[model samples]
Target: MSRIGVVTFPGSLDDRDALRAIRLSGAEPVALWHDDADLHGVDAVVLPGGFSYGDYLRCGAIARFSPAMLSIVDAANAGLPVLGICNGFQILCEAHLLPGALTRNEHLHFRNRDQWLRVEQTDTAWTSAYQPGEEILIPVKNGEGCYVADPATLEMLETTGRVVFRYLRGNPNGSQHDIAGVRNAAGNVVGLMPHPEHAVEALTGPSTDGLGIFTAVLAHLGTAVPAASRDRR
Candidate 1:
C-alpha cells in the first residue's frame, strides 16, 4: 500500500485528521515530524493546518524553516505529491514551493464556515478525482487565509490553469479570483486554505466531498505519471 505522510509541527492541530483521511482513502498513514528530515519513504506528504510555531513570526513563517521542510523542499521539487491545508498553505508559500502569499482576511476576523468550492482544474495530482467545474463543500477556518500575488503572477496562474479550487457561493477570505487552492507548475504540489481532511467524513464534516482529494492522490500514484509527461507550466 502507498504510504502518505502527514507532518506534525509543534502547533499543528490537524495532523491526525489528515492521517485519518489518508487511511480512509485506503493508503497507509505515516506520521512525520517537523524536526525530522526523513520522509520515511512515503509516496506523498501533507502539511496539516494549525498555528505552527505558535504563529509567532506569522502563521507558517517559522515552520517553513523546520528540519522536515528542508527535505520536503527538495522532494517537492522532484515531483513528489504534497498537499497543504489552511496554515499549511501559508507554509508552502513561505517555503516558495507555491507562488503568492497568504495575508490577513479583508474583514480582519477569523472566518470559519462550510465553504463551497468549485474544482477549476482536475489534471493535478491532488484534484484528478474531481471533475472540472464540480462543486464541493469543505470547512474553512483561518485568520490569514487571503491569497495574493502580483498581476503578472495572477495572470500566469489563471492562463496556465494552475488555479485548482475556487470559492463558489461566496469569497470567504477575499482570495484573489476566488482562489481557494492552487497547484505548482508541475501539478505535484497543492496548497489551499480550506481543510479537506475535515470533510472526508459526513458524520463530522459538511460533506464527504473532501475524500476525493485524498483518493485522487492514490489514483495518481497508481498511474505513475512520468515527470517528463507532466506540464512544465
Candidate 2:
C-alpha cells in the first residue's frame, strides 16, 4: 500500500482527521511527529491544518523550523507529492515551497464555514481526480486565509496554470483573484486554505467532494484501486 505521512505538530488540531480521511481513501496513514527527522519511507505527505506551535509569531512561522519540516521540505522539492492545508499552507509559503503568503482575512475575523471551490486546474497530483471546472464543497476556518503574491509571481502562476483551486460564489477571504489553492512548478506539491479532510464524509460535512483529492494522489502514485472500484458520485 502507498503510505501517506501526516505530520502532527505540537498544536495541530486536524492531524487525526487527515489520518482518518487517508484511511478512508484506501491508503495507509502514518503518523509523523513534528520533532522527528525521519519520513518513515512514506510515498507522500500531508501537512494538515492546525494552530501549530500555538500560531505565535505569525501562524506558521514557528512551525516552519520544526524537525519534521526539514525532511518535508527536502522531499517536496524532489517532487514528492505534498499537500498543505490551512495553516499547513501558510507554512509552505513560509518555508518557500510555494509562492505568496497568507495574511489575515479581509474581515479580520476567524471565519469558519463550508466553502465552495472551483477546480481551476486538475493537472496536479492532488487534484487529478477532479475534472477541470468541477466544483467542490469543503470546510474553511482561519483568521489568516487571504493569499497574496507579487505581481510578477501572480502573472507567472496565471500563465503556468499553477492555480489549482478558486473560491466560488462570493470570495470568502478576499484572496487575490479568488485563489484558494496553488501548486509548485512540478505540480506535486500543493497548498490550500481549506480543510478537505473534514469534508470527506457526508454525515459530518456538506459533501464528499474532498475525497477526490486523496484519491487523486493515490491514483497518481499508482496505488489507487481499480477504476471499477472507484466510487464515482
Candidate 3:
C-alpha cells in the first residue's frame, strides 16, 4: 500500500485525523516527528493543521524551522506530493514552498465552521480526484487564513491554474481571490486553509468530500511511476 507520512509538530492538533483519513483512503499512515529529518520513504507527506509551536511569532513562523520541514521542503521541491492544511498552509508559506502568506482573518477573528469550497484546478496531485468547478464542504478553523500575494504572483497563479480551491458560497476569513488552496508550479505541493482531514468521515464531520484529496494523491502517484515501482513503494 502507498505510505503517506503525517508530520506532528509540538502543538499539532490534527495529525491523528490526517492519519485516519490516509488509512481510509487505502494507504498506510506513517507517523513522522517534527524533529526527525528522515521521511521513512513515505510516498507522500501531509502537514496537518494545528497551533504549531503555540502559534507564537505568527501562526507557523516558529514551526517553519522544524527538522521534519527541512526534508519536506527538499522532497516537495523534488516533486514529492505535499499537502498543507490550515496552520500547515501557513508553514508552507513561511518555508517559501508556495507563494503568498496567510495573514490574520480580515475580520480579525478566529473563524471556525463548515466551509464550502470549489475545485478550481483538478490538475494538481492533491486535487485530481475532483472535477473542475466541483463544490465540496469541509471544516475550517483558524485565526490567520487570509491568503495574500503580490499582484504579479496572483496573476501568475490565475494564469497557470495553480489556484486549486476557492471559497464557494461565502468568503470565509476573507482570502484573496477567494482562494482556499493553491498548488506549486509542479502541482506536487499544495496548501489549503481548510481542514480537509476533519471532513473525511460523515459520522464525525460535516461531509466526506475531503476524502478526495487523499485519494487524488494516490491516483497521481500511481500514474506518475511505473507499475512495478509503485508496487515496491
Can you give the lDDT of residue 59 in candidate 3?
A: 86
The TM-score that candidate 1 achieves is 0.95
- Better-scoring candidate (lDDT), 1 or 3: 1
lDDT, candidate 1, at 13: 95
Which candidate order results from sorting by lDDT in descending order?
2, 1, 3
Ranking by TM-score: 2, 1, 3
Deviating ranges (above 4 Å) for candidate 1: 223-233
Query: Candidate 1 vs candidate 2: which has greater lDDT?
Result: 2
Give one digit per residue, the lDDT tens place, for model 3 in 1-233. Answer: 78999999999999999999888777889999999999999999999999999999998898889889988999999999999999899999999999999998999998889999999999898987877999989998988899999999999999999999999889988889999999899999999999889887768999888888888898887834324223211
The digit string of per-residue lDDT tens for model 1 on 53-108 reads 99997889999999999999999999999999998899999999999999999899
The lDDT values for all models are 0.91, 0.92, 0.89
Q: What residue pairs are clashing in model 2? A: none
Which number leads on lDDT? 2
Candidate 3: where are CA atoms >4 Å away? 223-233
Predict model 3's lDDT versus the native: 0.89
lDDT of 2 by residue, 1-233 (tens): 89999999989999999999898888999999999989999999999999999999998898899999988999998889999999899999999999999999999988888999999989999998998999999998988999999999999999999999999987888899999999999999999999999988878877888888899999999995646326735
